[model samples]
Target: MEVVVNRQDRRKRRLVRLFLRLLLISLVFAAACAVGLLSYTKMQGPPPLNVTQTTVYYGADQSIIGEHHQGENRHWLPISSIDTEVIEATLAVEDRKFYSHFGFDPTRIGAAVLANLKTGSKSQGASTITQQYARNLYLSHDKTWKRKWNELLYSLRLEMNYDKDQILEGYLNTVYYGHGAYGIEAAAQHYFGKTAEQLNLAEASMLAGIPKGPSYYSPLFDLERAKKRQGVVLQSMVATGYLNQIEADEAHLEELTFVQNELDQPSTIGPYFQDTVEKELIQTIGIDQALFEAGGLKIYTTLDPQMQKEAEKWVASEMPDSELQTALVAIDPRTGDVKALVGGKDYTESPYNRATEAKRQPGSSFKPFLYYAALENGYTAATTLLSEETTFTIDEGRGSWSPSNFNDNYADDFITLLQATAFSDNIYAVKTHLLLGTDKLVEVAERVGVESKLKNHPSLALGTSGVSPFEMARAYSAFANGGKRVEPRLIRKIVDSEGEVLFEAEPEMTQVLDPKLAFIMTDLMTGMFDPYLNAHTSVTGGSVSHLVSRPIAGKSGSTSSDSWMVGFTPQLVTSVWVGYDKGNLQKPAEGQIAKRIWAQFTEGALKGQLKKEFPVPAGVVGVKMNPENGLLATEDCPTHRVSYFVEGTEPTKPCPPPAADGQPETEVIDEATKEKENLINRLFRWLGN
Candidate 1:
């Protein structure tokens, strides 16, 4: 019995020694891990914020045209500026033990882990206010393990650097609160038409409830959801001791007021144009997205209010909802200044900006590029091409493409390039496109500021590719402005809230087409206006001939679904498009819908301005030629028309009469003398035999 007791004592001592050794090793490992984590947190530093500013846009005349957010509508407010009740409610709902926790609550985290495990999902919330602030300030709201690790490191760093008040202030100011509003100040002004400091208990609690799920609790969008969320916030305040039972009940029943007076939305004068400017502010000029959403910027734009008014009047009067939809864009060809732009029939009924966003086939309006391509490749206005019905085969089993004229009336006779353009001859354009090469045409279109992606096919010559009205107007501006390619300018300059200049803009012009070619194009476009000049065959926009006060040049394009009339003057250029938003377009009354808009706008916008004529530049030769053979004309040439030719490309030879005439105009034979000479010749011939 004594030997067994001693053996048991020895066994117990050995077991106790083994447990102590293992415990010592675990403590050392834990101490090493804690030191490593602390070092990592030090490296993370402070959270950074690159917030967007609010921007105010002005017209060329310095009128308040638009106000838009750069990114998020936010205002950084100190804790003192924010209502105490609002802060209390946020703490209760977001982080209950926020003040006591050192960046994280291990107890809550453990609880969250167990709950998530039970539910078989990672959905139980465990992020403290500091963690949320870290994510909101520096990291994107992604749920990846990498992002989570970064958030943990950033939260620890934030806690180490900033006090509880500073972290809370940062979190409150940076939280997104729907409808472009961010932070407590922006939310207060957006929801209650009051400042953050002036927010009452009811308004503050409601505002605090919104940050949980902004869209779900947006009072303007969902009042019931917002009220329900507001009740939850009041209950949280009661439990957190910020409000007693009586105060919480009264706060819930209190009537909350929202934005009552005129909210500073974009004005009615140019809603579409303003929206477009806001979008392009970031897209084209490459402004930082944060700057755009941050608000508080002053922008000067290229809008002429008088012209905009005239544009709006014409669209509203001409095109009602009963008729087809329309888009109009006017620009200064020389400066690329967008003077007036109307995107749709009514901005109230539809806010979509059709001018800049929508793409529709310009149809024959696209031919100018093809013609420009031909001119560049050594083809003249007098160059003749057969306009008979023709078909060409396509590649890769797509079969053949047979393009038809607007009325399918093929001119079988020889058609001059200028005359064909006036008539918008489809066969003539397709033939020239094929001859000049499809790739060459696409190049000219791109060079002339047609920004939309163009199709590299033969039918592209017929304007089969979809384009916005702005693209058409900009392309036509090249011809009007002596071949200089100028993209439409919306914003002239931008200055941030701190009076720092962010961006300044001017017309960056590139001479894409030759001045001579541009002049010739302007001349060729006259056939569309002049019926008496082209034997009444090319009178396309002749109905508006009486309204045009200045020397104008342009083309008209019509497809089954889209009709376009894009014309320009030496001073100003304009494009008009008409189509149904849905369903194919039908022919408009009186004339094409585009023509009416163009004429109406021209009459109004150009009323007080001087009559501008296209300047005839150097490097061109004008000659009288037979339009039939594209050669120098004689007194009795079949057709006599003065054709301008690019120097050295003009026809050098004179027209020769047909053989039936038998003699030149310089020589003549009388009938009586001819008969006597014939008789004498016959008698002398008989005697010699």
Candidate 2:
């Protein structure tokens, strides 16, 4: 009996010890698995806070010109940059146990579950700050079990990899406020019209209450509701020991000034220019589209706000009341930085950026490119082409083409390159184009940064090819910038949210033309404004010549459907196009509107600027010559001006003195005999008197 009792006791003790060992092994395995999972999660670096922020565009003067964002207007700031009051208010309202908890608050979660279960609804929320941030970044704000499970996993990953302050900073930057604002910084700017650092305690409490229910609690939406929510935020702050009850009461009583509603915010300045900058940033600068989506970029552009205003003002004031639409672009000649741009009459009504996008026939405004080719091929300002009505026989397949001047007017005799350019003579231009093979003009256009595909034809010299005002401005910049080809630039530099430099323009320059040829070409362009070059017709720019307060080199051009005035000073280059949206013939009076707009815009934009003239290069020489015959000036010559040429290109022959009579041989100033004398003749006659 004793043996049986002892055996039973021993067997029972063995069974008990085996059960204890099994339970201990299970507990140890579970602990080891948990440790391994935590280590693996920590190895994965901090999850990306994919926060969308606002991108601000600054003008040349460092003034805010525009802003861009996706759905949210957000600006990220470091935790240290954020005010303490904002942090305290947010933490008090969001998660008081943020620093103590690993990722979520179990106590609060239990209480919320109990409340929801009892109410038979899922309205209660127990998401900690980390959990909310994780949801904002990688998950959606749905109350489904799957979304909550994913949010919990993301929160653990973030908390394990990043510090408490880092998670808090990310949360503060990504949390959405009302009125298209996300993050405290953007909310501060939108509501208070001040920076995050400038927010007072009252403003901080008021802003903190917005994220609870942005539509209901936004001060801009409802003052009474906002005040009530702010009181709740203040009470929470006092309970969390961040503020005393007395301080909370004082803040609740403080008067807060909210900014005008976001709907009432004025449209950004230089919308067309801003659009161009964005395009250049993406296309020309090769910025990643994703970077723009993630926003928080500072793009420093070359826009001149004052000049932009001047351009808009003049385009609005001078544009004809007809259906004539216009586009204007101004660029710094030396740097190729676009200073001002006006795409249309009203950007709100029409956002078509004609200055940078619309391509139209530039008429004689494109003559400079043709003349540039001529200059390179040893043609000087003194070179002559007969400006008479004539037909040119082409190859047998294409047949013959005839060119006519404006209003069927002609010089009849030989006209110097200076005179032909001033008169915009179509007959002389075609002759010059044929003289230089069509390929040479195309080559010159490409070398000078004209990106448009030009059709190689005789009429191309007469400006039949279609190109944008931007392309025209870029092409002319080479002439204005001492023959250096400059890529037109809108953005000067770009910085990312982390202060990383994404792009900085270095002002690309290539010497595409002989400095001497460029100078001579520029001088020839000036002839359009000079009355001395007038002969059969008025200089094309004569109508606006009186508006010239300084030496301006320019050209006026017109096709049946398009009108253009592209001109430049030493400091600036501007291209203005006036026309209908569709191809419609312009009225005769409409043809002159481009010149008026150009003149007014240039005069107004350059109001306080120095009056600069194109500088002559070292290899070029200025020689006084007969404007009609392209010969050296003689004592009896009635009209003469300084024509610039390469050292060897100046004419050797002198004008014959008076054809052996007191009456001059050539009709230099024939105002008395010519019945069709225009403004140029009147000015020259006035000067002769």
Candidate 3:
């Protein structure tokens, strides 16, 4: 009886000691947790919620051009906006106890530790939804105790500051889904071409499986692997009581039709122009590459969405053949706005951006600048220039310079400067360039906004030097807007998310020529359109001449390799180019391709707008001159034509009377003329032999 009593006493005492020991352990754990909570609470509020949003671009008409998300490819959604199925699937797979836990899930962490110990590697992860968000937000993915500790602290702070719904929504939006998608919305859009609110059970389960191993089971990379992972996610949903076995099985077995991602598709709008906007955005906001992409900037551009669409449509519909390429750029003359720009037929096929980057010879389109320089000098629209086949024996030992007209036949000796332009006479242009020094023409070109290097050689007048369509448009803008150069602008302003104007563009203009002289140049260009004026070729009155309704002036340029039609009205300036990316355009096709494109674009873009006439600036006077001679017109002169002349430049002398037989006088031939005649005779003789 005494031994039994002693044994009972010892058992009771041992039980009491065991209870005390457990109590002590609980107290110590509580103290450690309290210390951790305190430390986390003082951790500077999680380094400022660096949530990245998509930067939106707006056109001049306030329509959304595009949205670009830096590296995340994420679009944020509130918990209320997400589908119930997606939320349930996410809870089942990522954190079943998401609503119950504070920030760290002790049970999950303990299980992860035991699993990791068995594998002798930290491959097993136990981060809850909140903990994962903390890791993604503040800590790096490096597997180390320090990183884990920081993640834990950040998680605790998140729980303290935000509600359960807030934490879960942020986690769902921030976690990575495969194929460069982030957030539930981005994942849904990427996988099923829908929003998070539109996702069904089958798609939700599939997306729920991705954040665990995004690249490992990416649908784009491994479809079978992704399916298997999706099955795992569906089973988890069943086990977690969110779904029944039959429901989970049906969802798992349902054939998933993954719609294509919109980001992967080509833009329906002006993709090339959008690309240019992004490039300019990069230059505008000189920040870290990551920040620039993540800046969530609101960019307002000068693009006219309507004009851009039309330009792209015409370029594609007009130039269907892929062998030949085309680029068209349009600008508002008064504002320097790039209203329409198309670099190629289809941006997806090739995004080389020929409008801004391709440099080819401007051909005869460059003749306007030569005339502008001529007018700035002593020349006038009534000034006569000889457009005959002539040679300059500039260097007897080395070589001689001889310029030929487009047609083998030379013009009358007394063709006025305006008529010379009408026929696109190369001889007349070269003669004018020589009269006004070659260096003077180069200066005029630079002042008119030819950013590319120009040549001072005699061939420069023939546009042997290369220039981009952008340069061509801006240079022509001088004539369009009264002799002032307006720098072409892609973006007008940039604003931040807070409605703060971060940057604004001011119009950069410089007066390069006399307004009257520029108007006279415009007058000379108009002759290229009137068949009566340009009996040789009226590019405007050609097959596509019906497209132009208002008064407009332009030049058609062509070479063995490049073709161009750069034109402008008083309000708009546009330049069009056609050629192979490299090598000569050897195919024998229509010569009017460039002219036709210009006519179509001008007619379409100017539709529905008020007709604007080119205002003749002051100090410009009109005079009726004989097309045969640069003299005041009389009834006796043959084919009298009206010409614009700068006030002081018009001739005061009246034209001489016609010969009694109404025929021209025979003139003595000089050595240069005789040499040209001999060269022509020898060419015919060689052909005959």
Candidate 4:
């Protein structure tokens, strides 16, 4: 009887142990359920607010003008609002059991585990759509056990609180597709230039494949790789019953006709312009992180796309082969808006924006500033300077310094300042620089928009000073805008994602020179094309006559290695520079290529535009003068002798008398007489005429 009792006691103890084990298991299950419910409740606590969207505007002709961004920190759109095909394809490829699962699929988990075990590596993911949404929204994409557990719990909570459609909607709207694109709406517009509604099955499939690895499957990088990934997506859709085999086959066979419409269009304005606008936006409005990161902004630019296209095409086709790089900048002088810019040949080849970033010797381009300085310091077109032999020596601490003209043929002759400028005579310019003083020239250049560093020396007169194309354009604008300097700007306004105006560019104009002085300079520059003034040389006509269809003014500059042409109409200013990236001296023929480009672009851009000359304000007047003497001309003066002047500054007196000393002077006579004398001199002296 005692042995039987002991057996019964042992049986009771075993039964007790089994009961405790079952109770502990039930408690654990209950705790898990409570945790999951709490998590789900937290996730569904509040609906997200929609962020503001920004739109860009173009020019008066519908060219991109600038961009506007509005909103707070998030650029958010509901997933259900997006196209159905994109969602269908994404689910078909990313999570097949998304709809039927509660939060996670045990069968899929088991299958993934078995697959991983068989492959000896972890490659399969068993996350349902709800899980993926939870992971993207709440968890980092770090592949770790703890994070995975958290993701699983979050998925359960999301599924419990939201419907399958809601989960998917949130997921699609929040996922990252790389290239700075966030959400399907931004991705759709960025990659295909089409909205979600317009995406075709092939495009949907292509986008669906991107989330696996956007950079790897980007169509821009490798179309074949993208197509292959797309094929896999299509196959998956068929297998999972999202698509029938017939549909899948059709999709696979479909040639991807990605209409690169956005890229083909002149979508973005001048990069330098855009950069300037961005800087201002940051300074004035302060950057909205959310809009900047996720909002798809449509920026309207002040650029005329047609003109910008022509400028780019001309530069690319006409720049010399030896010149591996070149830069061009165009601005609306009246508004100080940048219209077009070419920073370099290819962005991928080099991202160093030469237009605004490079500071190089400006060569003869610097002469314009010197001339302007001379005008400001009481020098006039009629001012006489001895262009005869002259020299200057400076102590360089160790040795004496001297400079000479390119030809070293300095005749001791008096020439009008206007004549010297029209010819771009180096010796004359240097002598004038010495007389005017380097400090005064620096002051004029700075006021006129030369932002780069200037070296105080005689070479400054010859454009030995360094400056950028952007600065040159701005400086030239003073002439175009009648001596008013308008600071160059790219962006007109900045809006947040919510369409709040955070910043706007207020156009600023400052008078850099007296109106009369500017007119005098323009008139003098215009005479550069005068056949009489530029006789015996093959210099291109003045900027005005070169664009004879309209009025314009400009200067050409060539350093030992760099060639530049900066010009402007009343409405626009453009500067072009051509040279080796390494600063090697280019041949003259190479330099001409840049000029041809400028001519071609200007010709095409100005086509069909009204022919308008730079308006000479009421105080300015036309005058007649001898090309050789720059003195008042009688009624018998040639038609080529016409010039412009401030009303009070016009030449009113005859030229001064020649010196008493018997000095040999270059005689100015009629062309017929000059030709006869030249022939006789050539025969007698046996020297080339």
What C-alpha lDDT values do all the predictions have?
0.80, 0.85, 0.80, 0.70
Q: lDDT of candidate 3?
A: 0.80
Clashes in model 2: which pairs?
none
Task: Residues 184-274, candidate 2: write the lDDT tens digits.
Answer: 9889988888988888899999999899898888888789999999999999999999999999999999998877676426445799998
TM-score, cand. 1: 0.60
What are the per-residue Cα lDDT tens digits for candidate 3 across 25-141? Answer: 999999888887767575656445677866767888998776677666777777899999999999988888888988888998999899999999989888989889988787789
Is 1 or 4 the stronger prediction by lDDT? 1
- Output the better candidate (1/4) by TM-score: 4
For residues 1-689, write the lDDT of model 4, one tens digit per residue: 99999999999999999889888888988889877777665666533324344345555366444444442212345664577778889988888777777778889889988998899877887877777777777778886779878887777667666777777877776666656555686577667766767788888888889888878987767889988999899988888778898998888778766555232133344554555545555565576656554444544456677887788788768765554678888887788888788887765566678888888787776787888777665566766555555546544555444555445544345566677767666766876687667788889889988888888987788888778988998888888888888877766665544456655676788987877778778777655555566643333444335544566566777777788887777777888888887867656576665556666677778788876776777766777776566677654443236666555555676644444563323355553354344334323432221
**Candidate 2: RMSD to truth:** 7.0
Give the top-scoring candidate (lDDT).
2
| TM-scores for every predicted model | 0.60, 0.85, 0.77, 0.72
Query: Which 10 successive residues of model 3 have the least lDDT summed?
Result: 680-689
Clashes per candidate, residues 3 or more apart or on different chains: 17, 0, 0, 31
C-alpha positional error of residue 244 in candidate 2 after TM-score superposition, expressed in Å: 4.7
Model 4 RMSD in angstroms: 9.7
Kindly report which residue stretches of model 4 are placed more than 4 angstroms away from their true locations once superposed. 1-32, 35-81, 84-126, 137-147, 156-169, 174-183, 186-192, 200-256, 260-305, 392-412, 495-502, 536-549, 581-586, 654-689
Give the range where candidate 4 is weakest over 10 consecutive residues by summed lDDT.
680-689
